[model samples]
Target: MQPHNRRTFLALGLLTLTAACTGSHRHDPDGGDQRPDPDQPVRLRAVAATDTLLAAYDALLAAPGAQTALLQPLRAETARHRAALTAGTPSTPSTPPPTTTSPTTPPTPTTPAALAVLERQTAQSRLADLGAAGPPLARLLASVAAANALHAAALGAPAEPPAPAATPTPTGTTPGTSAPALQKALSAEHAAVYGYGVVGAHLPEDQQRTDARTAYAAHQSQRDAWQRLLTTLGATPTPAAGGYRLPFPVTDPAGAVKLAAHLETGLTTVYADLVADLPAPHRPAAATALRDCALRAHRWGAPDTPFPGIPDPTDPSPTPTTPTTPTT
Candidate 1:
C-alpha cells in the first residue's frame, strides 16, 4: 500500500475500535454515561442535605420558647420546602432494599423520590417550635412529622434516634395552641407591606412602579390571611406598626430601590425558613407564595443570601464561622 493509504487505513481501524469501546460503556436511560459508584455518593450527599436540614429544624423546634405566633407560619412554610426537596419528584430506586421498615426509620430513597418528605419534615419541626399554636398549627406539624417519620423508615434511617419529642403544652394558653411565631411572621409581613409603599413612591412613573404596587397588594393579602387565621384561633392579630424601621434611610430613588430590594430579599429568606417547616399537604400553597416572593425580590433587585440552589455571586471559596444554634 502507498504510505498515505497505509496511515489512513490504520486511523480508520483506531476510530472503529474507539467507537466500539465507547458504545459498550454503561449509561443511564437518559443517555448520559456515568460511573454508578460516583452517582451513589452524589445522591447520598443531596439526600443527606435534606435529612440534615430536617434534623436541624427538629432540634430547633425542641428549643425552649422557640414556638411563637410570628414563627408558626414560617415553620409551616419551611416544612413545605423540605418536602419539595425530599419528595417533590419521584425517582427510580437505584438500590432496592430487601424489606421496608417502620415509617420513622425507612431506608433513604432516591433523591427525587424523597424531596417532598424532606420538605414536610423541615416545616413540621419549625411549626412545633412555635408555641401556643392551634389545631391548624398542631395538625400541620403532626401530619408532616408523621409523614417524615414514615419517610425516615422508608429511607432506612435508624429508628433508634427517636422521633421528635412532643413539645411542652403552653401554660395559661388554650390547649394545643401557639401564636408567637405567627405573630412574628405577621409583623414581618406588615413591615414588608409598608416598605413597599416607600419602594413604590421612588420608582419612576413606569412599569417598575406598577409591578411594585402589585407586590405590595399581594403582601397585603398575605397579611390579611394571617390576621384571619389568628382571629379564627381566638387571638387578635398585632396591628401594623405606625412606623417600620428601615435597614437604611431612603434618601434618594436609589436608596428607596435598595430598601425595597432588601425588604423582598429578607422576606424570601424568612419565607424559605417557613417553607422548610411545614407538612406535605400544605407545602404546595406555601411554596407557591415563597416562589412568588423570590421572583418579585429578584425583579426588585434584592441581594441574594448564602444558600444552596441560589446563584453564587462571589469567589468560589468556603468561609469558616462559629457554630450557631438553629433558627426555626
Candidate 2:
C-alpha cells in the first residue's frame, strides 16, 4: 500500500462523512428541493384563464364566415399557455383548489367585439396571476399576459354595438387583504378604458393611432383582470358608467393624444397603489404592470413625473385640462 495515497483517501472519506452529517442534502439556495414549489398553485388560476380563452377562440371559429386563419394561431398560443400553466402548477391534495371553474353560463356564439372582449378578459386574469406567482413561473405568466394583450390587437376593429358579456359581479372580501386597493385599481382601469375609446376616435396623427391601439389593449387586459379577480373573491366589480365627460371637447387629434396620454399616466398611480398593497411575492407583477403602463403613457406624451405614480400633495400636478363632468 502506498502510505501517502492511503492517507489522502482517508482524509477525503472523513470530509465526506462530516458534510453528510452536517449538511443533510440542504435545499439549494437558488432552486428548490423535491418538496412541492410554493408558487406552483399560484399558476392554476392562470391555467383556468387560458382555458377560457381557448374556449372563446373555439366558439369564434365555429361561427360562419369568421376569420379562421387569423384566429387559429391565437387559439394555438392560448392552448400552449394552458399547457404550460397546467404542467408547472402542482395539483397536490393539500393545496387550495385552482380557481379553474368554467363560466357559469354556457358558451354563447361570438361576435368580433365579444371575441376581442374575451381576449382582453383572459389577458387581465393572467396579469393578476402573474402578480401571485414567484419567479420563473411569474415570468411565464407575464409572457402569457403580454401575448393575450397582443391577441386583442390582432382581433382588429370591434364590430357593431359592444356585446360585452355580463362579467360576474364581485361579492365579498376577506380580512387583512388588499381588497380596497384592488378595487381602486379596478375602478381606475374601467375609467381609463372608457376614456381611451374617446381618445381613439379623435386620434389625429397616424403614429398616434398606433400608440392609442397599444395603450387601449393594455387597459383592456388590466380591466379584465380586475373583473376576474373581483369576481373570484366574490366581490362585485364597479361597472363602467354609460359615458365619461372629457375635460375638453376632443375635437382634434391633439385632443385625442392628450386624453390617451392622461389616461396612461393616471393609471401609473393606480398600479403603483396596487403594488404597495400587494403581498411581497406579488409585488413584482404590479411593479411590472406599472412599468409597462408608464412606458405607454410616455409614448402618448405624458411628462415624466419624478416619482411616476406617487402623488406629491405639496407639488401636485394640475388637474387634467380635460373636464370631469358626466352627462348624457
Candidate 3:
C-alpha cells in the first residue's frame, strides 16, 4: 500500500476505537445542558477545527490592502462552515462552563500555498474521523475530505489523500431497479450545463469565456454518463428541467464567475451524497467525481474550506473504496 493509504488506514482504526469507546449516547433534543454530550465529543472537535480555520480567515481579512479585500467571499464561506458545524450556535448563559482542553489545533497556514497545504491536512484528518462517525456523518466527512484533497490539486500543491494510481476495481454488484444517486447526479449535471450556458453568455473575455465553454462540455459529458448508468440499472432517468432558478442575478463577468463557483460547489455536495449510495467497488469513481467538482469550483474562485461539503460553520456527504471512510 502507498504510505498515504497506510496512514489513512491506521487513522481510521484508531478513531473507530475512540468512537466505540464513547458514542453510546444519543443527541439531546433539549439545549438546557451546559455540559457537553459525551457522544458528541468528536463532533465538538470538528466544530473546534472549523472555528480555528475561521479565525485564520479573520486574520487574513485584517491584513493590509487588495489581497485581503479579494478574500471577502472566502471569509464568508469559512464563517458559513463554522455555523454549520454546531448546527447553529448554542445559546450559552454567562456562567463559566466546565473545561476540557481541545485536541484539535487548527492549521496555521499563513501564505496561499501554505493555506492549501493546511486544507489538505484538515481533509485527511476528517477522513480518519469518518470511520467512527455514523452513516450520515461519515458520508459527509468523506465528501468534505475529498473536496479538500482537490483543493490541494487546484492550488498546485500535493493532494492530501493521495490520488489513486491503480486501475479501478470493477463492481460486481448486480444492477438493481433503483439508482437514485445516478438520477440525482444527472439532475445536478443538467443544472450545471444550463448554468454554464448563462455563465458563458455573460463573460466576454477570451479566457473566462473559454472556461465557461469547457465547464459546459464537462457537465454535459457527466450528465450523459449518469444517464447511461441509470439506463443500465433499469431505472428511468428524469429529464432536465427547461430552466433552473439562479441563486442571484448574474449581470456581469464577476457575477458569471460567482455563479460558476456556486454551481460547482453545490455539485460537489451532490456527488458526495452519490458516493455513499453507490456500491463499494464503484465508490472510488464517485469520490473522484466529487473531487473533480471541487477542483472546478476552485478554478471559479470558491472559498477553499478546511473541509468541503460539510457545515463547519458554512455548509455539507460520502465515498470511496479507499479502505477508509468505512461507511455504514
Each model's backbone clash number: 77, 13, 13
Give each prediction's root-mean-square deviation over alpha carbons: 24.7, 22.1, 13.2
lDDT of 3 by residue, 224-264 (tens): 77777676666787776543456678889999899889888
Off by over 4 Å in 1: 1-178, 276-280, 305-328
lDDT of 1 by residue, 249-292 (tens): 76667886776666665554344344433333333334344445
lDDT of 2: 0.55
Let me know the TM-score candidate 1 reaches against the reference structure.
0.43
Q: After the best TM-score superposition of candidate 3, give how far the Cα of residue 159 lies from its true spot, in angstroms.
A: 10
TM per candidate comes to 0.43, 0.43, 0.53
What is the lDDT of every predicted structure here? 0.44, 0.55, 0.56
Candidate 3 Cα RMSD (Å): 13.2
Q: Candidates 1 and 3: which is better by lDDT? A: 3
